[model samples]
Target chain A: MIPVLGGSGPVIPSFGSGSSCEQNNGWWCTDWLREHWGDTLQPALVQHIELVAIAIAAGFLIASVLAIAGFRYRLLDVPVGGFADFLYTIPSIALFQLLVPFTGLTVLTVEIALTSYTLFVLYRNMVAGLRGVPEDALEAARGMGLTRVQTFFRVELPLASPAVLAGLRIATVSTVSIATVAAFVVPKGLGEPIFIGLDQNLFKTEILAAGGLAILLALAADVALAWFARAVTPWSRA
Target chain B: MSVLADQFTAHTFVDAFRFIGDNASLMLSKTGQTCELAFAALGIALALALPLGLWLGHRHRGLFLALGVSTLGRALPIIVLIAFGLTVLGVGFWNNTAALVVLGIPPILTNAYFAVDGADRDAVEAARGMGLTERQVLLRIELPLGLPLIVAGVRISAVFVIASATIAAIAGGGGLGDIIVNQASYGLAGVIAGSLCVSAVALLTALALGLVHRAVSRSTTARA
Candidate 1:
């Protein structure tokens, strides 16, 4: 049966449940889902997750370094962040199309586009978090004769943990949802079934059902990321 | 290749500018398309959200949960919604616009909710005591007071909606996305031209929203 919070469904479990797009012949919305997507589903899900995971990892790492650079240089903040915002507005599909000539339309295009998105949200949030760090905390850390790197790791990072985590939360959830859109380019993942259903237009129930699952996936990722943030940084909590 | 790379960058800039100059009609059409979407969505959001915001902000029902939910809406990437919409609505301008509107709603809702509701309750009571109708209270009192925050939210929403609308171009609804996507097939000049046009429109829309926001807020301040 389809798992749902309400009776509403787009059963996520059966990503590759059936071939019949029409004639509820082999595909009951419930039956299609009950079949358990098995091997086909698992690899698709893994690849989707990997694409997002790598992109977010790259984004966070690059942004953290750039944030530090922004803090040090200040000028880098405006131009770099502005550029990120510009990239943020570029349609991911359009960007993917742009990259195809060079990269040949693979996971790289998806990763780059998704990763670029994380930069805008993460850069803005991380910068805000770093700026919001209590000034006196840093003063005390510096007074202890800590080197710049040591001070950043020990003082700046710890105190700024909440904002950074908030950034990560935004980044993670956005990554989860945006990752599915990568299906437009890649053949694998939860999105493929939904797109596949659309391409065939055989099963409205199938497409809607699969799509509903992706939405649920997005919501779950958002909630989990928020919880992860709370767990990582207790000081930011109520 | 190295020498050509530098020339390409400069050449792309020139070509991009020329595209804007040549295809100003297309640029304007896409810009208008985006504007229409953002403004219509903002108006719809305000109609639903303003009153609810007043209640949430003023009443003590633990609005954090609601605010948190709206934040989640914001965090959900725009493209996911687009993909989902394309599947359900089967792709077109209206479907994409509808998706953008859904994406646009939460920010305005949360902002209006917070701004209007956060008004001084004592002031609300006084207005009521002075025989103000609910309409008067909202119009003459709470709304005027909350207008700044509400407008700020709209501004924020406008910025995002404009950006999201560009991606909506992939739906082939005839916006800047048309230019950007056709870049490769259309020639290098076309690609450079399209991207610059999209960026320019996105930036200009943001700037125009900011101006309108400032003007309205200023008028409110002057009236006060």
Candidate 2:
């Protein structure tokens, strides 16, 4: 099991290698990466993924409830949106630090901050998608003796899938990027190496590796989500 | 100095407010530095993105590039960008400023481009029919029409720069982040105070620019 905060050992252990790249502080040290890939880099990547997954999952659940309620009662839309906008305006770093007094320096603090960031994008898109469902389609469903629940499931949701999936794409990509900052609060995710490298005399190799992996992960998630959206909404392709 | 130290030891919200009060000068200076860095970057970003966005948008070209830049910008984390800057540019004001300028560019550029490109084609044609040169049409017509979105773009970038500027302190750049990051010296109350200040600056910037956006759009619509 991955060690939690204050207990996790030094992120980058000193290898004390006599290699030329290590001595010269080269930007991309292949030798160092090959040596620490499993013990260091891989775990950081896994932790980063876990942070993003948990935050997005939690954010999606909350945003869905908010979106549905806002859609049912249009009056709640302004206040709910205003709250999300308020959350979005706060920087990730500041939000994390602000939570520390309440949640302490734990993964929960990091996740709470990360989850809040996702709500604006996710809730906006979900509501827009639901509202964008054609009125005629809803009417047809009603004429066919479909109940409100059935009409929503069979008609509204599928119609709104494109916008909702688009929101997920954006929320996922951004959450991946923001999750790196969570390291400043909890010593987990790709940010750990980036911060550790900064603290450890600006270890060039570790910083580059971790930062590069984060960018790659975001791009990959974006592409995968785009593809998934297409695959799920086959009718939209036509 | 001893009194300041005692205030820094604050733990509760009231104590945090006291810390801000005692360190009023320090807080003010840090807040000013944050504004300086944020505005400097925003200025540079506007100068660079506005003209380019305007030109491309006027010609109805480079849609792909405009959208791609914003998408790429969104995907790249500001912290990682700052780390990269530290490696190449070394730690200083310019390093932080440059990273922030990159952060600010995409939104402004995308909005500017769209703002111009999406201006009413019929109005544009009508202007052209009245013997306006392409430059005149662009400057007189598209720019006014797109002003709202451009302002909105600036509003977004301003908020981003102010918020991200807090992290510049980690790279030896002076800002409110200094108090927050050096928790051992400033204490938890100081850190909270700094965090509150950063959020306040960011929210205020957004609010101010939001007013600008509304005003610009309102004036433009009234003109129409």
Candidate 3:
């Protein structure tokens, strides 16, 4: 086990040499990273990515199903959007507390909340994309004797790809961000380092490194997603 | 029943009310503090983002910049920003507010830029042709045309800031979150009470702004 940090014993601040090293190092140092990477930093980063990946994947799946349902039944859009917005309005901390008793401090609790957060972004974008498909294109597909399913898969889906890609990028970024707070619920990810940094008064280096890494992760993921979007939607350039 | 008996023996709503009543002063101050943090952030973000976005959109430049910023801002998590703020600036109002200000900026900037960029081109050209200076054209035409989306952006930021301000308590800046965060000592009733207040405030703020957004867009559409 990679030391959960808080369940038992007093928090032993073992990573760094001392405050003097931090002060001398000034904010972020390569030396400090080398010192901690094998044990603390790498694991936290991996876990952070894992949490974000799982939540976003799960969220995208659920949102896709819901979005399709809403699109198929126009009346479902209102209630679906409203419910997602309601879930979005709930403060993250409160949501965690509300779930902790029932879920008892599990990753499932974090995933549920994180997944719920993605629905509004994903569903709205998906619906909008589907709706925004040019009517002429749909008509042409029908004129070509394509069935509704064929028209949808060939004409509508390709047209909707850009919007869906945009939604996926948004959902991924937001999930990465929110998963940081999941440390409070379960001591897993960069959040663990953050809380430990705050609690242990290991202020400068630890928090900076952890927080900076999280930001970097987000930026990197975003850039990658944007690149992927462009590559996948080659027609968008024209 | 005696006052003490009544106070001790209470249901969830009664306990919630008692928690509110007992900490009435703290709740009020914290609520104000949270509002100040959120509003201050919105104010600063508006000051910085609006003009830049408007100018870029007016000149038909910086589309890439605007897009990059919106994407980047979404990627940066609120909690990490808060942690970074605390590390860089120490635990204070500035630290908490800085994080929130960053949070509020992208939507306002992106919307403002797109609003100007997407304004009716013919109206803008006509205004310019009819002896209006660039500044005047922007002020008289683009600004009005863009007002609906700009306000919608602010509304989004405001609601987001209000909801995220609860994290300020964790950062040691007092807010309604203080109640929920301190639920260890304040108990389950305090959590329920504080959460209700946060949710209500978030929903109410969003609802009010939503109404304003609709009115602005509706009037603009009517004019068009």
Candidate 4:
């Protein structure tokens, strides 16, 4: 029988009747959620966070180095930018599967795919942000007898903070969403519950809960990063 | 041992190609389905979003709405949307199409709004000064000037829809994703081949749209 919400409501015990809900394939069961919160949901949330964090952190580091290098050697910019764009074009699922032969069905494969996806956004932003630093500011730093490295750190880096953080914000939120797909291979993260629910006759409660959490996490990360960007770049506010 | 390992690795690549060749009709059909799903979603999203965005932009209003819709759209995962659709809409083509439409809307809407809104205000004023009707001002001045950004939004939406369409298989919708997800039936080579096809399609879509963007921008600039 196709399970319809409230279809079996009058016959079955309501609310905390977890067994009935499970049997009838009810839309949501709060009792099942409460039971699984500790063992299932929490760990999945934690893993989701870990996956996003590691992917963004690694992506930032790599993109930063590439962006800086591309800036220093203008000749390198085209190729590096092109490469990142190429990587960005590959869909997450395809990228994940493409790596499975080399890395197997491990977290490493997932991370590699996730990290590659971030490179385009992070690299493009970093390059644009750094290049966007005002010539006057650079001149002032040079006139102050600051070394190139010192000038970059004090003047250019601060000026570029807004763009860099904007990139981070975008990358972080996107990675959060993409990392859910990672669960297909590695069986970790919020996606774990989502796929589990899908496999188990479309468990509406689990899918909704996990999917809701993923969306919330993305928005939270976006807001936090936006605030952090504004905080770091006080001059921009003025 | 090293030689044998090298041969084995080489064989896997060759095997993947052979698999694709063997399943040429199946892969092509799946790819066609993917394109159909993506385009249908894009078309619906455009029909819905463009008028709203254009009207808002013409009036120079609702900046927050445009940006908010986009940000929220990006933050919402396609997989989650599909899963949600499955619960409410049930498994099938419509569910997948609806999820993909949500995916396609934001970029196009925001871009359309911003493109028109950010058009050369002086040109808009001049058009008004020349006694062009409001419709003429919008169609001739704002839209033409904003064509590049609007097209960019379309391009972004197209790529996103195409990529996310792969997950339609999870919702009992057919696409190359069917091959990727059904690894037991399709084998490792088939899975890899499916992924390769998806990547190729995505890259090609991006490239083709990019050329269109360039051509449109160039014509717009030449006219100016």
**Which candidate has the highest DockQ of all?**
2
Show what share of the native A-B interface contacts model 2 retains. Answer: 0.39
In candidate 1, list every pair of residues with a backbone clash: A10-A209, B53-B113, B57-B117, B58-B117
Q: How far out, in Å, is residue A5 in model 3?
A: 27
Candidate 3 chain B weakest lDDT stretch, 10 residues: B1-10
Give the interface-residue alpha carbon RMSD of model 4. 6.5
Tens digit of per-residue lDDT, candidate 3, span B111-132: 9999999999999999988999
Alpha carbon deviation, residue A15, candidate 4 (Å) = 21
* lDDT per residue (tens digit) for residues A36-79 in model 4: 99999999999999999999999999999999999999999999
lDDT of 1 by residue, B64-123 (tens): 755765766655556556655765576676677777777777777788777777777888
Q: TM-scores of the first chain across all predictions?
A: 0.83, 0.90, 0.88, 0.89
Each predicted complex: what DockQ?
0.25, 0.38, 0.36, 0.34
**lDDT (Cα, tens digit) per residue for candidate 2, span A1-238:** 5666796566664665546665678878898899888988899999999999999999999999999999999999999998997788776776787777667778998899999999988999999999999889989999999999999899999999999998898899889988989888778999988887887667899888998899899989988988899899988861
Angstrom error at residue B53, model 1: 3.0
lDDT tens per residue, model 4, B100-209: 99999999999999999999999999999999999999888899888888988988788788888988888888998887777667766777788778778877887898
Looking at model 1 chain A, which ten-residue stretch has the lowest summed lDDT? A19-28
How do all models score by TM-score? 0.79, 0.88, 0.88, 0.90
Cα error of candidate 1 at position B184, Å:
7.2
User: Could you arrange the candidates by lDDT from highest to lowest?
Assistant: 2, 4, 3, 1
Tell me the deviation in Å of residue A194 in model 3. 1.3
